[model samples]
Target: MQFLEASREQGIVTVTLSRGKVNALNESVIDEMTACIRDLAVDPAVRAVILTGQGKFFTYGFDIPEFLEYGKEDFLRYLTKFTNFYGALFLYPKPVVAALNGHTMAGGCMIAIACDYRIMVTGKARISLNEINFGSSLFAGSVEIMKMWLGQKNAEIAVYTGALYSAEEALGLGLIHEVAAEEDLVPRARRIAEEFAAKDGAAFGSIKKLLRGPLAERIRERERASLLEFVDIWYSEKTWNLLKEKQIRS
Candidate 1:
């Protein structure tokens, strides 16, 4: 794929986002990732998946500059696909772990939180759902997943403050399951994936469905309206100005 690299070892498949240095998500990246995850889901030999990114970013979130050129209809179509992909990942039938190798923000944070487990690299890298900082808003599915991981109070604090959190701070807020040195992030994540892979596949899938199914349903119920609202705010004069100033740095 143009934006992703996938490899397998034993029963674990690792998918790394490699779209430029920042790993920004565009329509193609989203489509490639969705296809990769779906393929792994039905592959009997693939027991678990590890999602990570190359270089200095797990992802810089959506490709804001590219999307800025899109009309509202096109942007809304892309947003719909993005939300659906994350929702599927949230309730994925097999174990999926996020190895946060670097900065994970906005849409990137959404992907990490959807995983069954999140292990972030310590030091320089930071993670946040800082959309509010830029005058943008989030979707219903992402907010639900954030609440599931961070609890109601912490989720409110994270979203409202738009703070960039260091690994230790994120761990304290329950944004990540653990923090590892940069060099050890993937290894730690793989070990966790292995532990999960050892469980009976059917049992794990069934329990995962039971745990997240209701949230997924709620997301489906409310996602369209939220997407419409999100688009309205995004294309508003203030948010559009803020977004135009945003750049994806290497």
Candidate 2:
């Protein structure tokens, strides 16, 4: 795929975000990732999945500059797909680990929070759902997933303040499960994935579904309305101006 690199070893699949340096998510990237995850869902040989990115960013979130060129309807469509993609990942039956190699911001943070486990790299990497800082709002589904991981109060703090957290800070906030040195990031994630993969696949899948199914249904019920509000704000005069100034540096 143009925006991803997928490799499999020992019943685990590793999907790396490979779009330039920051691995910015655009329509094509989301589509590819969604397709890859769907395929892995049905593959008996795939017991677990690891998601990560190359270089200095796990991802910089939505490609704001690219989306700026899209009309409102087009942008809304993409937003719907993006929300659905994360919802799918959130409820994915098999264990999925996010080995956040670097910065995970905005939509990228949404993706990380969807995973069964997250291991962010130590040092310079920061993570945040900082859309509010740029005048953008988040989807209800995303907020629901965040609440599942971070509880109601912490989720409120994250969404309201748009604070950037270092790996250690994110750990303290329960935004990430573990922090690993840069060199150990993927290896540590793989070790966790292996442990998860060793469990009986059917039992794990059933338990996961039981645990997450209700919230997933709620996400589906509320996502359309939330996405409409999100798109309205995204294209508003103030947010548009802020987004115009945004740049994705490779």
Candidate 3:
């Protein structure tokens, strides 16, 4: 199956991440996703978008095999990939909703947080930006972007401790907007997006821009730092072992 898929109807375009295995992000998925969002960003028919994933995983973050194989270069490429990958959701002018089916951790959580609205399933699904625990540091701008948007306290605790939060806990902490029973997630997320679509497009766009403006500027300035840091970790033995401990490969 294709790593990324988009189908638009009734003003809603749902972009699905269904890369096999853990739905991990890799080069192919990154390239396709960047192109997909760029295309929709220009399409007038797409008033709102729902970003989701298949199976029991939203994304396990980056594919670990590449990291193990390429060493330092993989890290640089990983950071660069996400800068462009996450750039889409951050820059998309319209409302974007995240319907996280499962395992939204590390990079998965970052993608969800970038959305205008987020809805995740309750139960045992875990979500977090857990790079620190994985022995990987976030791209420099990710610090400020996450701090401002997810709240400074969460940003500090989440990164420092690298803990994953349950859906209920996330709702309380404001990382995600709502939580639903697993099966109701996509429909509920669509409902939320449709409601937002009914609002004044210009007003919504303006407010989002206002909220994201400073952080977006910061991301632009330090986007390359993520690449540099990523490459540095690529050479770390700790990083390699973690990938193996997690039993991940290309």
lDDT, candidate 2, at 184 = 96
Local accuracy of candidate 3 as per-residue lDDT tens digits, 131-173: 8777777866667667866688778998899888899988888
Residue-by-residue lDDT tens digits, candidate 2, 1-250: 8888999999999999998878999999999999999999999999999999999999999887788789999998899889889989988999999999999999999999999999999998999999998899999988998898889999999999999999999999899999999989999999999999999999998999999999999888989999889888988899988887775654
Listed per candidate, the RMSD to the true structure in angstroms reads 0.9, 1.0, 1.9
Between 1 and 2, whose lDDT is larger? 1
Q: Residue 150 in candidate 2 has what lDDT? A: 87
Worst 10 residues of 3 by lDDT: 66-75
**TM-score on alpha carbons, each prediction:** 0.98, 0.98, 0.92
Query: Could you tell me the lDDT of residue 129 within candidate 1?
Result: 98
Ranking of all predicted structures according to lDDT, beginning with the best and ending with the worst: 1, 2, 3
Which candidate would rank higher by TM-score, 1 or 2? 1
Model 2 lDDT-worst window of ten: 241-250
Say which candidate scores most in lDDT. 1
| Model 1 worst lDDT run, 10 consecutive residues | 241-250
Q: Which scores greater on lDDT, model 2 or model 3?
A: 2
Stretches off by above 4 angstroms in model 2 are none
lDDT, candidate 3, at 214: 79
